[model samples]
Target: MFTRIASALLVAGLLATSAPAAHAQTTAAKKAAATKAAAAKTAAAKKAAATKAAAAKAAAAKTAAANAAAAKAAAATPVAPKPAPVPLTESLASAGIKDALNKGIVKAVQFASEPDGFNMNDDIHIPFPEDAILMKTTLSKFPGMNTLISTFETQLNRAAEAAAPKAKDIFLNALANISITDAISLVTSGSTDAATQFLRKNTEAQLITAFRPDISAAIDQVGAGKAYAKMTSQYNRIPLMTPVQTDLTAYTTQKAVDGLFILLANEESKIRKNPAARTTDILKQVFGR
Candidate 1:
């Protein structure tokens, strides 16, 4: 009976030790499982973030391609054409005439007002007046008459050059006041001096009235009166020479007008025949055809 009791005690001791060890192993297994589960969850979140980033990169590339295509399409589109110029009309012709005249008048005045303008130009130089030619011929017999004649001629040209500046305002005023009843007729007149002739015909009286006082003043300023007085006094002193009288103011005025018309005619011809001579936009528009 004693042997049996000892054996039972030993077995109970062994069972108690094994029970504690088993409990320790179970706790260790649970801790390992939880650590593995946490690691798996972290890896899954990282993969999901990577997928989202790749999707965003692809979407950005697609948007960029779309924008490029749109830009290229816009660049290939064509633009609209400009409108044509207006057709020929009477009002257009009138406008053309005014523009052409303004250009011609300004240029002609500029040419005539410069140094040696009338004096150097053989085409329009003022010679001795018709009545004064006989007097000049008679005076030539006297000593130093050639020098006096030359001085007189030079004074006449200087007077014209001085008076040319006055024509600007006068011509502009005439341009403003002159009538163009049949502008087409003037345009189609086929004559180079058609416009210039029109101006002379209508504005001659006005020009004479305006130019006389200016010419008179210029004559006095250029010492032409002194020269004329010397010539007349000397001529009158000649034995039995008839005293010749001529209106210097009227003569100068008429000659100046004649010279201006010649210049105007030449200018108008250039505008009509030569495309390059139309220097201004209005001139080009009017005379381009």
Candidate 2:
């Protein structure tokens, strides 16, 4: 009986020791699970942060590209024009003051048809001043001076006559400038100074270039340069007249401008006086009024 009781007690002791070992195993398993869960949570947080950072970088890059594109597009635009373009008719009408420019233009045009238009018109024709007229007075009197003065005048006429065809355009341009209101007033005003002013202001510079070649060609044709040297040499010998020297090209240019205005004014006046002359609806509408 004593042996049996001792054996039973040993068995109970073994069982109690086994229960503590099982409890230790369960605690270790729970600790491992907790650690794994914590690690997973930390990884998830890191992933979320990375995704947010990446999204921000992409948006910033897109914005920068868009700004760059906008700047490039803006740089590609052009600058605007200086003076605003007015209507052709309006600009012409504005050129004349009242009705004063009519007779001046008509007289100038008529003068163009005459012998002196380019050849004999003193105001329009140029060689040397009147004081130097003796130089061209006669070839026998001042042989060298005649050639010099003649060369200049001849070149001027050649240029003027050569430029005649261009007058059609000039006339048309002048017509457009005259408004009907301006025409009516012009009858009373009777002066073409405004037209002259316009030609001098607007056309002088451009015409200078246009006439250069013509003048040069004329000079070549007449041997004006050689003629000029001869005339100067002759003039130095003559003590009687103080010969005045002037540029024929400059003289012709000034005369041409004056003549153009005179012709424009004349045409303007005729149109104003004659209702039949205002052929177009626009012309009639403005002038007939």
Candidate 3:
């Protein structure tokens, strides 16, 4: 009986030790599976982050390249230069002896402004028509009458030169009405008369207003009014001479306008005759006729 009991106890002890060893191996296998799952998840996250970073870098590079191309295109375009004005040198050079008459007219007006401009200037102020000749003949017989007549003429002319710049302004203002077609025809046809025609048609009203004030101021300031009053008072006291009540300002202004038109006509003729005088390429092309 004692031997049987001892064998059963040994068998129980061996079974218990074998069971613990089997449980330890199962635990170790479960731990290893959990670790492998965690490692796979980490790898997936890193791959996704790298793909996102590459996509962002590609997008930034494309944007930078587009901006550089826009900047280059802006820098490549060129700017244009400004154009020139119409020239009149050709017409001036081509003008004939008619131009001398125009120059003479200008000299006449200039002379009228000086101290003895009209008074002593017998050459320009000589008699014209037979009716006026009688008056001249009558004045000529009296030695001191010529001196008195010349003083009045000089005062009248002094008023005229002071009014010239104002007249220039009026001419400039009226010049705008000269049509593009008219200008083109004038230059291409080689006609000096075109500008004169234009001036005659446009400048009357403007010249009247411009000449009045300037003439008035010049006459008052230049001692012309006093000289004219004195001369006229003496003339009225003459026995045979007719008493004249003329506005010298208006007469001088009319003469000035006539002189200006004559100059314009002559200048136009000169431009027509001389092609080399056309300074600009456009002028040469247009006025070559």
Candidate 4:
């Protein structure tokens, strides 16, 4: 009976020790499972964050590429140049006046410089001096006096025609020296011959002074002086006739200058009124308006 009781005590001790060991193993297994599950969840979250970051980076790259492409295209496009500004009205008017007047002067000079320019054209015909008209009338009654008067008048016209070309340079010089302070006013003036009138008012005295020598030379070349001397000699021989002393050079110069101005005025009128007369680009630009 004592052996049986000791055996039962030993078995009971053995079972009690095994039961505690089993309980400890079960708790260890549960802790390992929870740790594994937590690690997997963290890994999954990290993977999802990595994927989202990659997508965002890719989208940003795409947006940047698109912006770069747009910028490159903009750089490749050609831009148009800006147009030139229009000239001022006053400047245009002034230039137009100068060009028109120059052209008109050239035309007038060319026409008057031609043969029979003054004699054929009654507008510019040179006759015997007005101051000596009574001398002509008194001499006309004498035999061969009519022939002398006619010859003298023809020679006077020849002198003027010969002298016409020399006046062109003087005129051009005067034109070059002229100051057009009121160019706009002159252009807007309603008169067709306004430019010519202006030129005459400014340059007439200069023209006469410069042209008298040329007129005297032309008169001598064309035998106008000798013809005048002959006419005067006959007239001076008349009894009780008032002695007439007229400056042939001065008279012829004045008449010649007057003729040139008349022609110049006509040319200016044509330019102002006729569209076809605006031959140059500047002329068309100004007067075409």
What clash count goes with each model?
A: 0, 18, 9, 0
Enumerate residue pairs that collide in model 4: none
State the weakest 10-residue window (summed lDDT) of model 2: 94-103
Per-candidate TM-score against the hidden true structure: 0.67, 0.44, 0.50, 0.67
Q: Scored by CA lDDT, what does every candidate get? A: 0.83, 0.59, 0.58, 0.84
Clashes of 1: 0
Provide the lDDT at 164 for model 1: 85
Error of 2 at 80 (Å): 53
Could you give candidate 4's per-residue lDDT for residues 1-289 as a string of tens digits?
9999999999999999999899999999999999999999999999999999999999999999999999999989987786554453777778888888887788888887788888889899898799899998988888988987887788888888877787777677666644556677767789988888888988889889878998899889988799889888878888999878999999999998999999998987887888898888787776665
CA shift of 250, model 4, Å: 0.3
Tens digits of per-residue lDDT for model 2, 177-255: 5655654454334452444555456555665666556655655565655666566566657667565475655665556
Question: Which residue runs of candidate 1 sit more than 4 Å off their true CA positions?
Answer: 1-86, 178-180
Per lDDT, the best of the predicted structures is 4
What is residue 270's positional error in candidate 1, in angstroms? 0.4
Give per-residue lDDT, candidate 2, residue 13: 97
